[model samples]
Target: MDKSVSKSSQPSGGNGFPTSSSNGRKLNKKLVYLCSIVMAVLFFLGIAAFVFLFLLHKNPKATNKNIASFRVDSIFVSRFKLSSSKITASWDIRLSVQNPSTASVSYQTFYTWIQYKQERLSNVTNIAPFQVRGNNWTAENGKLVAKSVRADEKVIEDMATEMANGSVNFNIGLYAGFWIGNEEAKRVWRAVEAHCSDLKIGFSSKDNMGKLIGEPIECILTKTW
Candidate 1:
């Protein structure tokens, strides 16, 4: 009697290897794992950024306290004359700066100016670079000179009226960049703007000399990036 023969049930791939469908499934799995790894890395980075911003938002008062403070101790005007066309003045400004940071602070790009009402009457003079120790105060004596500076009509009128009444109010403005670090290292840099307004200086008769009155004025401070 003759026996019946049956065909082989193995895959068609060479050397009895896995079929094309099985190879496709393995490649798909690899792609999935790669995508998952990339997404996980991105997610952690995003979380880190959010945490940093949240901490900054929650500690505004601490940030302000750690920056610094500025105060105008006194001002002496030796010569101040103004007209509609021109202005001239010599000012000796005594000021103090307090650094609350733990690191030493150095200041540069120091600028000082004088303003009458809202009108500026002098050029912005550059002060010498200086440094203040950590958690300490430093006194800076600044001399501002304005010679033949063009004056606005409103500024001259207001200044003359105030001088005639025995006292004139002017605003002293200062700006500088502060670096927080020791002499051997630098960590961060910041810009600060300080305005000491309502500076009442008393003058007698038509004399150009004047002295600051009342208490020392603490300047309003603003920080820039």
Candidate 2:
């Protein structure tokens, strides 16, 4: 006799549509493959970030260009006399301030001091507000004077001895704030401090006028914030 197939005699997943268990297997495989792809992408991105940071660290000059430079061009002492109990002097200072960065810099009021044998002297003038463009420089002038000011006995003696030797050493300190900006707008101000040390001013007995000796003194720049 001719046999007939029943619905229950066929395979459980023999229909055009897969069974529930077969669908579950395919879905799990797709989820696993998606997760692997995501992980691979993340790993490559992390490697790229690491390489970029390493390159930046290796090349620091790219960021150092924002800083400026300062130098003491000349210092003239028109009069300087040290007595047993007092001191008297007149100093004219010239500074060359250069903006080596790509941005323009606007300076605030500058505070400058002169020191002899570590003793600060009285000053009359300060550097006024100014601005400089990229790769530009400016000459700043200041005056310091001491008119029969009382001095320490030790300092007076030391200064007198040094002056007789034809040269005297002094230190120059500068403190100020500056704003850095592009063409669009300006940013906040940053404080800076500079120190130019071991400045030698040589004097002649004939004229008694002292002038800076040797090469131009470069100031040590420090950023306060």
Candidate 3:
């Protein structure tokens, strides 16, 4: 009788192949954990940005009401002299400024001039800087003196007409450096212009004094730069 040989079957790399599959599973789990951590960081950053924008919209630095509060309180043309050759005049102006915000408002190096029919009649006079406290009002004064301004035939005619009418309308121009906050060093200065369309004054050919005709009129203020 012939003896039969028994055959045994076995897999290649016996248990090592199964160990490699286990390692692959562990690597996949690690990758998923890293992705989750990155997504969480992005979510927090987005939340922070949204909160900052919401707060900024709720509170603004300057408002229309606050800017509109600035006005010319009074104006006095104390003396106005007219001659065949030249014209001379002096005037006093007062400004009422109000600040409605929490920060202090400051005005500096202000200069003012008088105009008639878009013609500049006098030189600019410098006024000192002034500050208005938060939620408060402040009065500032300005003075102008025009001397020996050469008068033309048209100017004389205009003067006569105004004197006869008993009321002369003049425009006032103003330029100032301003800052809105308490930290003045960090604040930027800007130019301002004021126009007084309702200014009324009485001119007499015999007397040098020109009387104010009516109540103080409000001036329109605008930013130049």
Candidate 4:
């Protein structure tokens, strides 16, 4: 009788290596497909973000409207103190602020300084912040007590002459920071400056002390961002 050997039925590749199961091949194909989809989505998202940021940078004014709608409505000098070395004044001022944009605006820590002939006389700081609604006007009131302003001989002389003339010309400087939009929307912060020129303060001399003659005079106001 002749002896015959039988071979197994397992599948093999060209290299004669055992092939993977059909289920395992299917699972590998699914994983590769899923990875490709995820990569495509991420690439599209990155491109969209880049375009948005580019547009935002190009049109900054659209994001933050200029805060030019600020003005000095009125001012009232309640007390005045003049001395040989320094001068001090206290006053209440009212401001009219308008938000022209559709978004709200807010500011913190207001400061004001009184100047005469380009000389800094006094300054007040640390006032409270204010907020204005969209496309609306609001009145903000604050009191300022200026610190003692040291003066030289020429300044004192000019002050005396102006007091004798019954009107003193002064300048007022204002500074603050403003933020656009509310908490829900993106916010932008900017610095603002205001200058009121030729503010004429009228006073009368009584018993060697200066007394306010009438309401504070309105002055030319200019603003910069």
List CA RMSD, all candidates: 8.3, 7.9, 9.3, 12.0
lDDT of each: 0.83, 0.79, 0.71, 0.68
* Reference-based lDDT, residue 197, model 1: 94
lDDT of 1 by residue, 113-179 (tens): 9888777777888889999988799999988888888877777887888889999999988898877
Deviation in Å, model 2, residue 142 alpha carbon: 1.9
User: In model 3, which runs have C-alpha deviations exceeding 4 angstroms?
Assistant: 1-69, 184-188, 204-206
Taking the tens digit of each residue's C-alpha lDDT, what string does model 2 give over 13-84?
Answer: 776567899889999999999999999999999999999888766532235434667899999987777778
For candidate 2, which ten residues in a row score worst on lDDT?
A: 57-66
- Model 3 local distance difference test score: 0.71
**What local lDDT score does residue 141 receive in model 2, on the 0 to 100 scale?**
89
Q: State the local distance difference test value for candidate 2.
A: 0.79
lDDT for each residue of candidate 4 in 1-225, tens digit (9 for 90 to 100) = 123222333344435565667668989999999999999999999999999988765544364345546666666665576778787787666767767666677876567776778778776555689888887988777676666778776887888788788777776677777787787457877666777776666665653333233454333335445
Runs in model 4 deviating more than 4 A are 1-60, 63-65, 207-225
Residue pairs with backbone overlap in model 1: none
**Which predicted model would earn the best lDDT?**
1
lDDT score at residue 80, model 1, on the 0-100 scale: 82
Tell me the TM-score of each prediction against the true structure. Answer: 0.69, 0.69, 0.66, 0.61
